[model samples]
Target: MTVTQILAAPAAHTAGTAGPVRGRRRALRRALWGAQILIAAFLLFASALPKFAGQADAVETFTRIGWGQWFRYVTGTVEAAGAIGLVVPRLAGFAATALIGLLGGAVLTHLLVLDAAWALFPAALAAVCALVGWDRRAETRDLLRSVAGLPRR
Candidate 1:
């Protein structure tokens, strides 16, 4: 075969390999991230609804949560947003960033101004974010690479 044909053969083989490579990468990434997404979803649901009925500190809970019924709206929205964001290959890496930031602020609020018990909520979510960040370091690295405008170095 001609040199052109020889070069074309490798390109053609790579084109074929691309499909399986991407698929495996996607599955790996998804598996790593699925747990984090579930955690986010669960947190959103709980935060959206105060499960403890008629607890002694009902008013205090609402007050410390800092949004009353609006807390439901805000937490639900952010949690769901983060949940959805976790799936986007481009955004999943930083999904942990925004979420963990929120969780960190939450932990601080609990320590400083709210019930100590409330700290668990944010701490749990923060753990999820950290796990996601760690497991999907490659994806997060990809995200930061783009954000920093550097090549895939």
Candidate 2:
């Protein structure tokens, strides 16, 4: 009936048994975040590092793609950046979205230029990135809006 009561209604409604559900949701989110970080780290070390170092396999792969060694460094840099961004809470979704593109390129390279069998790894990584980005859609939207200098809703 009162202005104060009206304004406080929503908070009051959440002040009771909603605690357990909220706790569970928080736990689930934490678990998913942990998994996301682990995957990003794995990609950083397993794939990105070798590319940056110009390891034989990476050089050969890039050569097969007809892009030369320079492109290896570029892809490695992007992957490294994305991996770092993945650990930052505000940047996770954006990073995952970027990684999706990078990994998609890998997939295309495998399918078009290299052996199709080699495409599996990048395809899986891309799928995981897609899931991460979808799960953090709100964060992605916020980051995009901020980058575009648009007013937030």
> lDDT winner among the candidates?
2
> Candidate 1 residues 67-132, lDDT tens each?
675554565567677766776667775787778987897788788877679799779878767756
TM-score of each: 0.56, 0.79
lDDT of each: 0.63, 0.78
- Please report how far candidate 2 places residue 33 from its true position, in Å: 1.4
lDDT of 2 by residue, 1-153 (tens): 442332233322534646654455445457668878887788799889999887899899888888678998998889889989888988998898889999899898888989899899889878777767766767778888999999876
lDDT of 1 at 93: 56
- Model 2 quality (TM-score): 0.79
